[model samples]
Structure formats: structure tokens, C-alpha cells
Target: MKRLALILTLLSAPAVAQDAGLAARDAAEALEAASILLDTAEDSRDRVAALTDTVRAFEDGLAAMRDGLRDAAIRETELTRKLAAQDAEVAQLLGALSALGSRAEPQTLLHPQGPLGTARSGMLVAAVTPGLAAKAAALRSDLEEVTALRELQQSAAKTLEDGLAGVQRARTDLSQAIADRTDLPKRFTEDPIRTQILISATETLNGFASGLSQITENEVAEVMPPIEDRKGILQLPVRGVIIRQAGQADAAGVTRPGIVMATRPSALVTTPTAATIRYNGPLLDYGLVSILEPQGDLLFVLAGLDAVFGEIGDVLPAGSPVGLMGGDGGDIVSLTSEGGGAGRSETLYIEVREGGTPVDPLTWFTTE
Candidate 1:
């Protein structure tokens, strides 16, 4: 019965070992699947977690591998220390041998040929010879360990380099996404707040662009003369209805060589180009008047008129009619310079402009 029991126990041992091996294999397969899932994860936080788990698995997978490396380091330190100690002993032995050879009284230290002499010499040599042999063997082993450690460190460095490259790629993608978000604009890129400034700058540049290539400030002199009697032009100074016309000296107290005009009370006034109307309040003795700079050298007419026409600031061609002489035409009237400083009285109410400066009006007008 005892023999039978032993046989049964022996048969069960192999079966138990096989079951344990199968269980360990299953665990390893599961871990490998987990690693694959971790590698394929998309989320950054999840990826980091997976990488951590992978590192943990690697550490656990070959825990003995790490132990072996640590053991190698410890052994290396131990071997190095032993080698140093051996070298010291060898050095001491060499010194003693040297002293023996160089001694002047060598005869006193000499050992006669005998077993006792050989024994003493052997004792001194024994101090370093075996230790040196042991150190050489250990150094060879240490070189192998060093090579292995270098390989391991290289692998770690490569892994870190690859991981850093992946991180940099991710950062670049994110930055590009952000840049694309900010670059949306239909025309030239402009934020709402900056539109006004952009428009203003564009308008200012447009105004300058026309004259930029050819026009100069000095060219103003050609369009406007400085002297009250010199040749140039001036612009009309206001906008209003024509009330008094030029011509007809036979009408009731209203006879000026040039036109006398008036504007409604609500007319808007603005300076045209560069001009200065040379007049105080009630001018020409014609009633509230001012002269305009001339258009160009042009003919002047007289005596055939009926109504007061032409408003202030009215841009006129060379022979534009001022107006007919007198017909009702309320208290509204303005007289402009016609020829010289003479207009019924010797009062000169002329406009002037030149070179960004104002010139005289009567200079350019010719009498008709």
C-alpha cells in the first residue's frame, strides 16, 4: 500500500507543474495584449498612462535582468577594490626585491642555496603574485559587464530620443491647428477693431498715391500766382444761389464791372482749393462781397445785363455768365473782382493763392 501511494504522488507532480506553466503563459499573453492596446491609444493622457504601464510591465517582465545588472555593478566595484589592493601588495613586493638587489651589503641578506632560502623568497613573492593573477581575470570579466551596461544605456537613450521626437511632432500639429484658426479673413486680414485704422490708412495712401509719382509742392505756383496783379487763378469761396448778376451800369445804383452775387442765408460755406478772399465785411460798396481767384486768362464783358446771377463758390468756365443786372433781387447780393483794383470805387477785393500760398485774383482776368 505504501509503494502504491508513492507512485501516485510521483505521477501528480508533473501534472501540477504543467498546470502552473500554462497559467503563467496565459498571464504573459494577456500582458502582451494590454501593451498592444496601450501603443494604439489616441488620447495623450491615455497614451502617457499606457507608456507608464508598459514601462512597469517591462520592469516586471525581467525583474531578474535588473537584479543582474545591479549585481554586475556591485561586483565591478568589488573587483576594482580587490585589484587596487593586489596592486599595492605587488608594489610592496617589487620594492622589497629592488632593495634586495641594490643593497651594498648584499652578502648579509643573501640566502645560501637551501630549502629555507627558497621558502623565504617564496613567501615574499606569494604576497603579490596570486593577487595579480586574480585581478587580471576579474578585469576581463568587468570589461564584459561594462560592454553590456553600455548597450543597455544606448537602448534607453534611443527610446528617449524617439519619444521626444513624437512629442515634438504632436506640438507642431497643435500649433498649426491654432494658426489656421487665427488666419480666417476674406480680403486682407483685418480684425474688427483694426478695420477703422486700416481704412483710414488706405484712404490717406490713396489720396497721396495719385500725386506720388509726379506732383510736387512747388507745382502749386503754376496754378496760383502770389501777386495781386500777377497771372494765376483762385477758386470760388462759397456755395449759394445767384442773386446779383454782373453788367449793366444803367440799373438802379447796381453797376459793377464784374458780377455782384448773393447767397441764401442757409448756404454752406467752404474754401475751394487754396484761396483767400481779400475783403472786409461790406465790400465793393455793392454790399457784402468778395473776389475770387481767376480761372484762366479770359475776356470780360460789360453793359448788356439784366439779372444778378452766379452764387459764391460757383466753379465757372472762362465765359460763365455772372448774371443779368437788376430785377427785384432782395437785399441779397455779392460783388466779385472783375479786372483791376477798380470796381466803381478803388477798393480791391480780390482772392489770391500760390505755391500752397494765396495769390491775387485780378491778375489773371481780362476786360471785355
Candidate 2:
């Protein structure tokens, strides 16, 4: 009877173990499916955000163009007034010269032959010649003023035209971005209240920087690829030459731990890698600035933009357009040591930080 009981227990144990194993496998499969769904949702949310940024960028571009046009018009009006004044002066001088020319013959003015000729020549030398010389000088000055005014007007007009073209390009790009993401599902929406707070907060950069350090981000279980793996492989956010490198001292004698790039007017700025926008607005003396977080404990600071696209918390993919550099409208002047000046339309400042410590960005980008 004891032997029979032992055999029955062994058979029951095998059946129970098999049932547990099957249940564990089913649970694992369910968990995997849920993870996949979560990933898909995040992807769709990012797409919608990117599309929204594109639309906002287009709107901003149009507004900028309008502002530029208005400025151009004002400048042109001023130039026109100056030119008109110069034209009147030139006309007056020409009229005086014409009257003098009509009264005297060239031969009599140049060489007198008799007593009447000698008297006329004395009169010409005493009064007419001096007046002519003065009028000619005035005419030359007026002509120079007119020429300068014309050049200024032409430059203003060209700037306005370029701004219009930029707006149209922005519109087309916005449309394309919208179409590309139309099929995506949205899992996240922007919080207007939070965004307003960020925009309206008139705090110093140090204050904002401190606040940023305290904000916690939602954790995703998936591991992010390390930035270290992409050393010397990443492209620059903008196409330009690096004018200032990290740890260089500026004119102010303060050491700067970022890179400064010289770019063309209205050049587009993009993300070098996938990142979440930490902040986007004016910060201190940097003008329009953008702060991005690409991975844990890493942040990128981009500054000196005229217009920015994404809001805080917006996720952008690698190489996604974020904003454009402010154009000089052919009016910017940078003084040099030679007592001359050059046009520097835009300057982009880039700073990288790892755990709040500044790091050299040249090690990460393929600047060539």
C-alpha cells in the first residue's frame, strides 16, 4: 500500500510542474506584447510632435518675413527722402551752371583779346569762376549721397525679397512634414499651461538652469545607446566652420567652454541626435536658446537663434530641423583689428554638458 501511494504522488507532481511552466510562458508573451504596444505609442507621439513643430516653424517664418518687409519699407522710405533731397540739390547746381554757361562764350572766358574782352575776363575770374567751383563741389557731394542712398535701398529690397523666399520654403517644408506624419497615432498632447509658464517666466539663466536640474523625466525601461559609441561619427547640427572651440577665451577675457560656429544668414538648425527639448526661449545674453537632452545626464545647449521651432518636452529625431538663424539682411557689421568690418549674419554657440560638467564637443562631431 505505501509503494502505491509514492507512485501516485510522483505522477501528480509532474502534471503540476507542466501547468506552472505553461502559465509562466504565457505571462512572458503577454508582457512582450505590452512592451511592443508601448513602443509604438511613443513613436506615434514623437511623430505628431515633430509635425506640430513643423507647422509652428512655418507660421513663425511667415511672421518673420512680414516683419522684415515692414522694416525694409521703412528703411526704403528714409533712403528715398534723402535721395530726393540730394537730387534737388544736384538740379539746383545744374541750373546755376547752365545759366553761367549761357551768359559767357568759352573763348572769351578762356582768353580775352581786347579791352571789352579783358573787362569780361576780369568779371569771370572775380565772381563767375568761384561760384562755378563751389557749385561743382556741391554737385559732387550730392551725387555721392545719392549713390550711397541707392545702394542702401537696394540692399534693403534684397533682404525683403530673401525673407519672402524663406517663408515660402518654410511653408513647403511644413506641408511635407505634416503629410509624412498624418498616419501616425497620437499618444501624447502638449500641456499649454506648462508651456506658458516656461515662456512667461522672467528668470535669469542661472535660475532656470537650476530649476531644470530638479525636473524629473519619465523613465522608459529601454536602454538608450551611449553617446560614447558615436564619437567622431556624429554630424554637426548646422553646416558651418567652428570659429571658437571649447576652453577658449573670448574678448571679455572669460573662458568659454563651448563652440561658436559662423553660419550663413537664415541657415536652418537641426538636431545632431535624437533628443527631448529641455527648454527653448531667450536666456540671458544668448538670445534665442534651445536646450536638449539626448540621453541620461547629458545636455546640449544651442544659442543665438532668431526663431525656434519645438517647445519644451518635444522629442525630435536625429537631423530634425529645430529652427533658423537670424539673417543680417546684409546689414550686420563686425569690426576687425584692421579698422575694417565684415558681415557676420549669424553666430551659433554650442555647449555640451555631461552631469552638469562642460565637455568638449569636438570629440563627438565629424566637423570635416
* Top of the candidates by TM-score: 2
For all candidates, the clash counts are 19, 0
Q: On residues 1-368, what C-alpha lDDT tens digit does candidate 1 reach at each position?
A: 22223223323333322232232233333334434544554444434234333433432322222222233344445545665766765576566556545333635434677768866866765575566557555555555544443333333233323332333343233333323332211111213333333334443222222222121122222243333443335333222222333443435774433443243221212233333221112221233333333322221222122222333223333322232222222211112332222112211222233332332233443322
**lDDT per residue as tens, model 2, 201-224:** 746444455456334344334233
Best by lDDT: 2
Please give each candidate's TM-score: 0.22, 0.46
Candidate 1: residue 265 lDDT (0-100): 21
Model 1 quality (TM-score): 0.22
lDDT (0 to 1) per candidate:
0.33, 0.57
Displacement of the residue 257 alpha carbon in candidate 2, Å:
0.8
Q: Residue 162's C-alpha lDDT in candidate 2?
A: 41
